[model samples]
Target: MQDKIYFIELNEDKKYEDYKQYHSLLPLEKQQKIHKFRYDIDKKLSLIADLFIRFLICQNLKLNNKEITFEKNPFGKPYLLGNPEFHFNISHTRNAIAIGISGNPIGVDIEKIKCADLKIAKRFFSSNELEYILTNKEDSFFYEIWTKKEAYIKWDGRGLSIPLDSFDVTGGPIDKMLRMVTIHGYIISVCSRQDFNGAWCMELAEDSVPVCLQKIL
Candidate 1:
Protein backbone atom coordinates (compact mmCIF):
# COMPACT_ATOMS: atom_id res chain seq x y z
CA MET A 1 0.00 0.00 0.00
CA GLN A 2 1.09 3.59 -0.63
CA ASP A 3 2.15 5.70 2.30
CA LYS A 4 -0.80 7.63 3.77
CA ILE A 5 -0.71 10.61 6.11
CA TYR A 6 -3.56 12.18 8.08
CA PHE A 7 -3.83 14.98 10.61
CA ILE A 8 -6.49 16.55 12.81
CA GLU A 9 -6.73 20.14 14.02
CA LEU A 10 -8.10 19.90 17.56
CA ASN A 11 -10.73 22.13 19.10
CA GLU A 12 -9.44 23.48 22.38
CA ASP A 13 -13.00 23.73 23.67
CA LYS A 14 -14.27 20.33 22.52
CA LYS A 15 -16.90 19.00 24.88
CA TYR A 16 -15.89 16.78 27.76
CA GLU A 17 -18.46 14.26 26.57
CA ASP A 18 -16.70 14.07 23.22
CA TYR A 19 -13.42 13.41 24.96
CA LYS A 20 -14.99 10.62 26.96
CA GLN A 21 -16.44 9.06 23.84
CA TYR A 22 -13.08 8.88 22.06
CA HIS A 23 -11.21 8.00 25.23
CA SER A 24 -13.41 4.99 25.64
CA LEU A 25 -12.25 3.58 22.29
CA LEU A 26 -8.65 3.20 23.40
CA PRO A 27 -7.26 0.13 25.14
CA LEU A 28 -7.42 0.23 28.91
CA GLU A 29 -3.63 0.69 29.10
CA LYS A 30 -3.67 3.70 26.80
CA GLN A 31 -6.76 5.15 28.54
CA GLN A 32 -4.94 4.89 31.85
CA LYS A 33 -1.91 6.69 30.42
CA ILE A 34 -4.13 9.49 29.10
CA HIS A 35 -5.80 9.82 32.48
CA LYS A 36 -2.38 10.30 34.07
CA PHE A 37 -1.76 13.53 32.18
CA ARG A 38 -2.43 16.56 34.39
CA TYR A 39 -3.78 18.83 31.63
CA ASP A 40 -6.69 18.25 29.28
CA ILE A 41 -4.71 19.17 26.17
CA ASP A 42 -2.06 16.63 27.07
CA LYS A 43 -4.73 14.01 27.49
CA LYS A 44 -6.43 15.00 24.26
CA LEU A 45 -3.24 14.95 22.23
CA SER A 46 -2.31 11.56 23.59
CA LEU A 47 -5.79 10.19 23.02
CA ILE A 48 -6.15 11.46 19.45
CA ALA A 49 -2.71 10.39 18.26
CA ASP A 50 -3.19 6.86 19.59
CA LEU A 51 -6.78 6.50 18.39
CA PHE A 52 -6.05 8.02 14.99
CA ILE A 53 -3.60 5.26 14.11
CA ARG A 54 -5.60 2.49 15.78
CA PHE A 55 -8.78 3.21 13.85
CA LEU A 56 -6.95 3.59 10.57
CA ILE A 57 -5.21 0.24 10.96
CA CYS A 58 -8.40 -1.45 12.07
CA GLN A 59 -10.24 -0.13 9.04
CA ASN A 60 -7.49 -1.06 6.65
CA LEU A 61 -7.18 -4.60 7.92
CA LYS A 62 -10.91 -5.10 8.56
CA LEU A 63 -10.18 -6.25 12.10
CA ASN A 64 -11.74 -5.47 15.42
CA ASN A 65 -10.06 -2.52 17.11
CA LYS A 66 -10.02 -4.37 20.39
CA GLU A 67 -8.16 -7.32 18.84
CA ILE A 68 -5.30 -5.25 17.43
CA THR A 69 -2.17 -5.16 19.55
CA PHE A 70 1.13 -3.27 19.36
CA GLU A 71 4.69 -4.14 20.21
CA LYS A 72 7.85 -2.04 20.17
CA ASN A 73 11.10 -2.73 18.41
CA PRO A 74 14.39 -3.08 20.23
CA PHE A 75 14.78 0.64 19.62
CA GLY A 76 11.31 1.32 21.02
CA LYS A 77 9.41 2.10 17.78
CA PRO A 78 5.90 0.70 17.92
CA TYR A 79 4.48 -1.74 15.35
CA LEU A 80 1.33 -3.78 15.05
CA LEU A 81 1.64 -6.97 17.08
CA GLY A 82 0.80 -9.68 14.54
CA ASN A 83 1.26 -7.70 11.33
CA PRO A 84 4.94 -7.05 11.64
CA GLU A 85 5.35 -5.92 8.04
CA PHE A 86 2.89 -3.05 8.41
CA HIS A 87 4.53 0.07 9.82
CA PHE A 88 3.21 3.32 11.26
CA ASN A 89 4.28 6.38 13.21
CA ILE A 90 2.36 9.08 15.07
CA SER A 91 3.24 12.61 16.12
CA HIS A 92 1.46 15.61 17.60
CA THR A 93 2.27 19.22 18.33
CA ARG A 94 0.08 21.26 20.62
CA ASN A 95 -3.32 21.40 18.90
CA ALA A 96 -2.76 19.02 15.99
CA ILE A 97 -2.06 15.30 15.53
CA ALA A 98 -0.60 13.44 12.53
CA ILE A 99 -0.16 9.75 11.72
CA GLY A 100 1.57 7.93 8.86
CA ILE A 101 0.95 4.33 7.84
CA SER A 102 2.43 2.23 5.08
CA GLY A 103 3.14 -1.32 4.01
CA ASN A 104 6.77 -0.43 4.62
CA PRO A 105 8.42 1.47 7.42
CA ILE A 106 7.32 5.08 7.84
CA GLY A 107 7.79 8.07 10.12
CA VAL A 108 5.93 11.36 10.52
CA ASP A 109 6.08 14.52 12.59
CA ILE A 110 4.05 17.74 12.94
CA GLU A 111 5.12 20.96 14.62
CA LYS A 112 3.34 24.26 15.13
CA ILE A 113 5.21 27.04 13.38
CA LYS A 114 6.80 29.48 15.73
CA CYS A 115 9.86 31.65 16.05
CA ALA A 116 12.99 29.63 15.25
CA ASP A 117 15.24 28.99 18.19
CA LEU A 118 18.84 29.12 17.02
CA LYS A 119 20.10 27.77 20.31
CA ILE A 120 18.16 24.50 20.05
CA ALA A 121 18.93 24.38 16.35
CA LYS A 122 22.63 24.72 17.01
CA ARG A 123 22.51 21.99 19.60
CA PHE A 124 20.57 19.39 17.62
CA PHE A 125 21.10 20.24 13.95
CA SER A 126 24.11 19.39 11.84
CA SER A 127 26.46 22.11 10.59
CA ASN A 128 24.92 21.97 7.11
CA GLU A 129 21.45 22.05 8.59
CA LEU A 130 22.35 25.00 10.75
CA GLU A 131 23.69 26.86 7.71
CA TYR A 132 20.55 26.07 5.74
CA ILE A 133 18.29 27.44 8.46
CA LEU A 134 20.46 30.49 8.99
CA THR A 135 20.60 31.26 5.29
CA ASN A 136 16.86 31.13 4.86
CA LYS A 137 15.12 34.20 6.20
CA GLU A 138 11.78 32.54 6.85
CA ASP A 139 11.14 30.89 10.22
CA SER A 140 9.49 27.98 8.43
CA PHE A 141 12.89 26.77 7.29
CA PHE A 142 13.78 25.81 10.84
CA TYR A 143 10.67 23.69 11.28
CA GLU A 144 10.97 22.27 7.79
CA ILE A 145 14.44 20.99 8.59
CA TRP A 146 13.54 20.12 12.14
CA THR A 147 10.58 17.97 11.20
CA LYS A 148 12.50 16.26 8.40
CA LYS A 149 15.24 15.31 10.83
CA GLU A 150 12.66 14.02 13.28
CA ALA A 151 10.87 12.01 10.61
CA TYR A 152 14.14 10.52 9.44
CA ILE A 153 15.13 9.29 12.88
CA LYS A 154 11.72 7.81 13.42
CA TRP A 155 11.88 6.19 9.99
CA ASP A 156 15.25 4.77 10.95
CA GLY A 157 13.49 3.33 14.01
CA ARG A 158 16.60 3.71 16.16
CA GLY A 159 15.14 6.72 17.94
CA LEU A 160 17.41 9.00 19.99
CA SER A 161 19.99 6.25 20.28
CA ILE A 162 21.12 7.80 17.01
CA PRO A 163 22.50 11.30 17.33
CA LEU A 164 20.44 14.05 15.65
CA ASP A 165 23.56 15.95 14.57
CA SER A 166 25.39 12.93 13.16
CA PHE A 167 23.68 13.10 9.78
CA ASP A 168 22.81 15.95 7.41
CA VAL A 169 19.29 16.27 6.04
CA THR A 170 19.73 19.47 3.98
CA GLY A 171 20.58 17.67 0.71
CA GLY A 172 21.52 14.06 1.03
CA PRO A 173 19.98 10.68 0.19
CA ILE A 174 17.73 11.14 3.20
CA ASP A 175 16.25 14.29 1.69
CA LYS A 176 15.07 12.24 -1.27
CA MET A 177 12.80 10.11 0.92
CA LEU A 178 11.18 13.04 2.78
CA ARG A 179 7.93 14.81 1.92
CA MET A 180 6.77 17.94 3.73
CA VAL A 181 3.66 20.12 3.88
CA THR A 182 2.53 23.10 5.93
CA ILE A 183 -1.09 23.60 6.91
CA HIS A 184 -2.82 26.09 9.17
CA GLY A 185 0.42 27.47 10.64
CA TYR A 186 1.82 23.99 11.27
CA ILE A 187 4.52 22.06 9.42
CA ILE A 188 4.41 18.28 8.85
CA SER A 189 7.05 15.94 7.47
CA VAL A 190 6.72 12.31 6.40
CA CYS A 191 9.53 9.89 5.61
CA SER A 192 9.35 6.54 3.84
CA ARG A 193 11.30 4.36 1.46
CA GLN A 194 8.70 4.97 -1.24
CA ASP A 195 9.16 7.77 -3.76
CA PHE A 196 7.78 11.09 -2.55
CA ASN A 197 5.38 11.45 -5.50
CA GLY A 198 1.61 11.06 -4.96
CA ALA A 199 1.74 10.47 -1.20
CA TRP A 200 -1.36 11.93 0.44
CA CYS A 201 -1.00 14.41 3.28
CA MET A 202 -4.58 15.21 4.20
CA GLU A 203 -6.12 17.50 6.80
CA LEU A 204 -8.95 15.78 8.70
CA ALA A 205 -11.81 17.42 10.53
CA GLU A 206 -12.42 16.33 14.10
CA ASP A 207 -15.73 14.67 13.12
CA SER A 208 -14.42 13.21 9.84
CA VAL A 209 -12.38 10.27 11.06
CA PRO A 210 -14.90 7.80 9.67
CA VAL A 211 -14.78 9.46 6.26
CA CYS A 212 -11.30 8.06 5.69
CA LEU A 213 -12.38 4.61 6.88
CA GLN A 214 -15.13 4.50 4.27
CA LYS A 215 -12.76 5.64 1.51
CA ILE A 216 -10.09 3.12 2.43
CA LEU A 217 -12.65 0.34 2.69
Candidate 2:
Protein backbone atom coordinates (compact mmCIF):
# COMPACT_ATOMS: atom_id res chain seq x y z
CA MET A 1 0.00 0.00 0.00
CA GLN A 2 1.15 3.55 -0.72
CA ASP A 3 1.94 5.62 2.34
CA LYS A 4 2.49 9.18 1.15
CA ILE A 5 1.58 12.58 2.59
CA TYR A 6 1.59 15.88 0.69
CA PHE A 7 1.92 19.43 1.99
CA ILE A 8 0.74 22.36 -0.14
CA GLU A 9 1.05 26.02 0.68
CA LEU A 10 -0.67 28.99 -0.93
CA ASN A 11 -0.44 32.72 -0.37
CA GLU A 12 -3.84 33.74 1.00
CA ASP A 13 -3.48 37.11 -0.68
CA LYS A 14 -4.21 36.19 -4.26
CA LYS A 15 -5.26 38.89 -6.68
CA TYR A 16 -8.79 39.04 -8.05
CA GLU A 17 -7.55 37.90 -11.44
CA ASP A 18 -5.73 34.99 -9.88
CA TYR A 19 -8.84 34.01 -7.99
CA LYS A 20 -10.96 34.31 -11.10
CA GLN A 21 -8.63 31.97 -12.96
CA TYR A 22 -8.63 29.52 -10.06
CA HIS A 23 -12.37 29.80 -9.59
CA SER A 24 -13.09 29.01 -13.21
CA LEU A 25 -11.45 25.62 -12.85
CA LEU A 26 -13.35 24.62 -9.71
CA PRO A 27 -16.21 22.15 -9.77
CA LEU A 28 -19.67 23.65 -10.28
CA GLU A 29 -20.72 23.01 -6.67
CA LYS A 30 -17.55 24.60 -5.35
CA GLN A 31 -18.09 27.54 -7.70
CA GLN A 32 -21.56 28.04 -6.25
CA LYS A 33 -20.17 27.95 -2.71
CA ILE A 34 -17.52 30.49 -3.63
CA HIS A 35 -20.07 32.79 -5.21
CA LYS A 36 -22.33 32.42 -2.22
CA PHE A 37 -19.56 33.85 -0.04
CA ARG A 38 -18.46 36.59 -2.42
CA TYR A 39 -18.48 39.18 0.33
CA ASP A 40 -16.56 37.06 2.87
CA ILE A 41 -12.90 36.94 1.86
CA ASP A 42 -11.85 34.56 4.62
CA LYS A 43 -14.51 32.03 3.70
CA LYS A 44 -13.66 32.40 0.01
CA LEU A 45 -9.97 31.72 0.61
CA SER A 46 -10.79 28.64 2.70
CA LEU A 47 -13.03 27.27 -0.04
CA ILE A 48 -10.32 27.89 -2.60
CA ALA A 49 -7.77 26.07 -0.48
CA ASP A 50 -10.07 23.09 -0.03
CA LEU A 51 -10.72 22.95 -3.76
CA PHE A 52 -7.01 22.91 -4.44
CA ILE A 53 -6.54 19.94 -2.17
CA ARG A 54 -9.45 18.15 -3.77
CA PHE A 55 -7.96 18.80 -7.17
CA LEU A 56 -4.62 17.34 -6.14
CA ILE A 57 -6.26 14.27 -4.70
CA CYS A 58 -8.23 13.68 -7.86
CA GLN A 59 -5.19 14.00 -10.09
CA ASN A 60 -3.07 11.72 -7.93
CA LEU A 61 -5.70 9.04 -7.57
CA LYS A 62 -7.13 9.40 -11.10
CA LEU A 63 -10.64 9.47 -9.72
CA ASN A 64 -13.65 11.17 -11.27
CA ASN A 65 -15.62 13.88 -9.50
CA LYS A 66 -18.82 11.87 -9.27
CA GLU A 67 -17.08 9.09 -7.38
CA ILE A 68 -16.19 11.21 -4.38
CA THR A 69 -18.41 11.52 -1.33
CA PHE A 70 -17.54 13.29 1.92
CA GLU A 71 -19.06 12.56 5.30
CA LYS A 72 -18.10 14.22 8.54
CA ASN A 73 -17.85 12.52 11.89
CA PRO A 74 -20.18 13.56 14.69
CA PHE A 75 -17.39 15.85 15.85
CA GLY A 76 -17.06 17.31 12.32
CA LYS A 77 -13.98 15.46 11.15
CA PRO A 78 -14.39 14.88 7.40
CA TYR A 79 -13.99 11.39 5.98
CA LEU A 80 -14.51 9.41 2.79
CA LEU A 81 -17.71 7.49 2.26
CA GLY A 82 -17.94 3.99 0.71
CA ASN A 83 -14.16 3.72 0.63
CA PRO A 84 -12.46 2.28 3.68
CA GLU A 85 -9.29 0.94 2.08
CA PHE A 86 -7.59 4.33 1.94
CA HIS A 87 -7.27 6.78 4.78
CA PHE A 88 -6.57 10.51 4.69
CA ASN A 89 -6.73 13.70 6.74
CA ILE A 90 -6.43 17.39 6.01
CA SER A 91 -5.43 20.55 7.87
CA HIS A 92 -4.91 24.09 6.71
CA THR A 93 -3.53 27.14 8.40
CA ARG A 94 -4.14 30.71 7.28
CA ASN A 95 -1.50 30.44 4.55
CA ALA A 96 -0.86 26.75 4.05
CA ILE A 97 -2.59 23.41 3.51
CA ALA A 98 -1.56 19.88 4.42
CA ILE A 99 -2.92 16.48 3.28
CA GLY A 100 -1.99 13.13 4.77
CA ILE A 101 -2.78 9.96 2.74
CA SER A 102 -1.99 6.44 3.75
CA GLY A 103 -3.28 2.89 3.92
CA ASN A 104 -3.50 3.35 7.68
CA PRO A 105 -5.69 5.92 9.39
CA ILE A 106 -3.82 9.23 9.56
CA GLY A 107 -4.35 12.81 10.66
CA VAL A 108 -2.56 16.08 9.80
CA ASP A 109 -2.76 19.68 11.04
CA ILE A 110 -1.18 23.01 10.07
CA GLU A 111 -1.10 26.28 12.03
CA LYS A 112 0.22 29.74 11.34
CA ILE A 113 2.34 31.33 14.03
CA LYS A 114 0.79 34.56 15.18
CA CYS A 115 0.93 36.60 18.38
CA ALA A 116 -0.62 34.11 20.75
CA ASP A 117 0.93 34.48 24.20
CA LEU A 118 2.59 31.59 25.98
CA LYS A 119 0.60 32.32 29.14
CA ILE A 120 -2.23 30.12 27.86
CA ALA A 121 -0.01 27.13 27.29
CA LYS A 122 -0.87 25.99 30.79
CA ARG A 123 -4.45 25.36 29.67
CA PHE A 124 -3.37 22.84 27.04
CA PHE A 125 0.14 21.70 27.86
CA SER A 126 1.11 19.43 30.68
CA SER A 127 3.11 20.79 33.60
CA ASN A 128 6.27 19.21 32.20
CA GLU A 129 5.63 20.79 28.81
CA LEU A 130 5.06 24.18 30.44
CA GLU A 131 8.34 23.89 32.31
CA TYR A 132 10.16 22.95 29.12
CA ILE A 133 8.75 25.92 27.28
CA LEU A 134 9.70 28.23 30.11
CA THR A 135 13.25 26.96 30.02
CA ASN A 136 13.41 27.34 26.23
CA LYS A 137 12.57 31.06 26.37
CA GLU A 138 11.46 31.09 22.73
CA ASP A 139 8.00 32.01 21.57
CA SER A 140 8.48 30.32 18.20
CA PHE A 141 9.53 27.13 19.94
CA PHE A 142 6.51 27.34 22.15
CA TYR A 143 4.21 27.70 19.15
CA GLU A 144 5.78 24.66 17.61
CA ILE A 145 5.04 22.70 20.75
CA TRP A 146 1.48 23.99 20.83
CA THR A 147 0.76 23.11 17.21
CA LYS A 148 2.17 19.63 17.63
CA LYS A 149 -0.10 18.98 20.56
CA GLU A 150 -3.12 20.35 18.75
CA ALA A 151 -2.41 18.25 15.67
CA TYR A 152 -2.14 15.11 17.76
CA ILE A 153 -5.45 15.77 19.43
CA LYS A 154 -7.15 16.28 16.09
CA TRP A 155 -5.54 13.11 14.83
CA ASP A 156 -7.09 11.28 17.74
CA GLY A 157 -10.51 12.29 16.31
CA ARG A 158 -11.56 13.77 19.65
CA GLY A 159 -10.81 17.38 18.76
CA LEU A 160 -9.95 19.99 21.43
CA SER A 161 -12.96 18.70 23.40
CA ILE A 162 -10.44 16.32 24.89
CA PRO A 163 -8.28 17.85 27.57
CA LEU A 164 -5.10 19.06 25.86
CA ASP A 165 -2.88 18.22 28.82
CA SER A 166 -3.98 14.61 28.93
CA PHE A 167 -0.87 13.41 27.09
CA ASP A 168 2.75 14.37 26.44
CA VAL A 169 4.87 13.80 23.32
CA THR A 170 8.57 13.27 23.81
CA GLY A 171 10.69 14.24 20.81
CA GLY A 172 11.72 11.10 19.01
CA PRO A 173 10.91 8.92 16.03
CA ILE A 174 7.13 8.45 16.13
CA ASP A 175 6.28 4.91 17.12
CA LYS A 176 3.19 2.76 16.58
CA MET A 177 1.11 5.36 18.43
CA LEU A 178 1.75 9.15 18.40
CA ARG A 179 4.60 11.31 17.14
CA MET A 180 5.39 15.03 16.99
CA VAL A 181 7.79 17.20 15.06
CA THR A 182 8.55 20.86 14.36
CA ILE A 183 9.00 21.75 10.71
CA HIS A 184 9.59 25.14 9.02
CA GLY A 185 7.80 27.35 11.56
CA TYR A 186 5.01 24.76 11.76
CA ILE A 187 4.30 22.17 14.38
CA ILE A 188 3.34 18.87 12.69
CA SER A 189 2.03 15.79 14.40
CA VAL A 190 0.56 12.55 13.11
CA CYS A 191 -1.35 9.64 14.65
CA SER A 192 -1.71 6.41 12.74
CA ARG A 193 -3.07 2.88 13.08
CA GLN A 194 0.48 1.50 13.31
CA ASP A 195 4.00 2.80 13.82
CA PHE A 196 5.14 5.42 11.30
CA ASN A 197 8.81 4.73 11.37
CA GLY A 198 10.96 6.15 8.52
CA ALA A 199 8.15 8.29 7.12
CA TRP A 200 9.33 11.08 4.79
CA CYS A 201 7.67 14.43 4.18
CA MET A 202 7.38 16.62 1.07
CA GLU A 203 6.92 20.36 1.46
CA LEU A 204 5.24 22.14 -1.47
CA ALA A 205 5.87 25.74 -2.41
CA GLU A 206 3.69 28.29 -0.66
CA ASP A 207 2.83 30.23 -3.81
CA SER A 208 1.72 27.25 -5.86
CA VAL A 209 -1.50 28.05 -7.67
CA PRO A 210 -4.70 26.21 -6.79
CA VAL A 211 -6.12 23.52 -9.04
CA CYS A 212 -9.74 22.43 -9.46
CA LEU A 213 -10.49 18.85 -8.41
CA GLN A 214 -11.90 16.22 -5.96
CA LYS A 215 -11.34 12.52 -5.13
CA ILE A 216 -13.31 9.66 -3.55
CA LEU A 217 -10.47 7.49 -2.15
lDDT of each: 0.83, 0.63
- Least lDDT summed over 10 consecutive residues: which range in candidate 2? 208-217
RMSD of 2: 4.0
Residue 171, model 2, lDDT: 48
Best by lDDT: 1
Listed per candidate, the RMSD to the true structure in angstroms reads: 2.5, 4.0
Candidate achieving the largest TM-score? 1
The whole-model C-alpha lDDT of candidate 1 against the native structure comes to 0.83
Q: For candidate 2, write residues 107-183 as lDDT tens digits.
A: 77666666657778877777877888888887765776676676666667778777877777544433335555556
So what's the TM-score on candidate 2? Answer: 0.75
* Regions of model 2 farther than 4 Å from truth: 16-41, 114-116, 171-184, 193-199, 206-217
Clashes of each: 0, 3
